[model samples]
Target: FAGIGDPERFFRSLRAGGIDVARTRPFADHHMFSREEIAALAADALREQLTLVTTEKDLARLRGSEGVPDDIVPFAVELEFDEPAKLRQLISDHLYKARERRFNTR
Candidate 1:
């Protein structure tokens, strides 16, 4: 969800299609932030008491360095189908199961 355009619209579309999104962030495209910028972003996250995250694609572009924190997670969004219902259901199920597995292990 990070480093993409129109994340609000994207979330709205997801909601319209019956998908529930707890949180979202849309960082600038190709956002190669400096150390200070990374610290600022992390500080913002700390202030909100929310985890900082970005897209895996954006991470790839960043050479795995800069202001991004070690705790920052990269959200990978994949489009498997053009059909709306099937796509949403598929993604929702996958992420739900994934999250359950993640927390259950903890």
Candidate 2:
């Protein structure tokens, strides 16, 4: 189950990680799942003997919500850049220019 901006991307990531996704339930980005909905998902997973996995963002949203299964796992992903130094320099330059503009405006 996934409630994110690009659930298909998440599914793809799972597949890339060699996880065999037998089924999926996707909701709109940032969808606020109701207790009943969570319960239903839990029931389905339990009945199917499948594990529940979701993205970290969705896990944060569902955190502290009642009926959330204890075994539900949150998948965390990291971004790898081909040119780390170049990306860092670009970001630094952008931030420096933005700061200069802000001060100039002030």
Candidate 2 wrongly placed segments (more than 4 Å):
none
lDDT of 2: 0.92
Point out where model 1 deviates above 4 Å.
Answer: 5-25, 82-106
Cα deviation of 64, candidate 2, in Å: 1.6
Candidate 2 on 1-106: residue-level lDDT in tens? 8998989999999999989999989999989999999999889989999999999998898899887888998888899999999999999999999999999997
Where is model 1 poorest over a 10-residue stretch in terms of lDDT? Answer: 1-10
As a whole number from 0 to 100, the lDDT of residue 46 in candidate 2 is: 90
Candidate 1 whole-model C-alpha lDDT, 0 to 1:
0.67
Worst 10 residues of 2 by lDDT: 66-75
lDDT of each: 0.67, 0.92
Could you report the Cα RMSD, in angstroms, for every candidate shown?
A: 14.3, 1.4
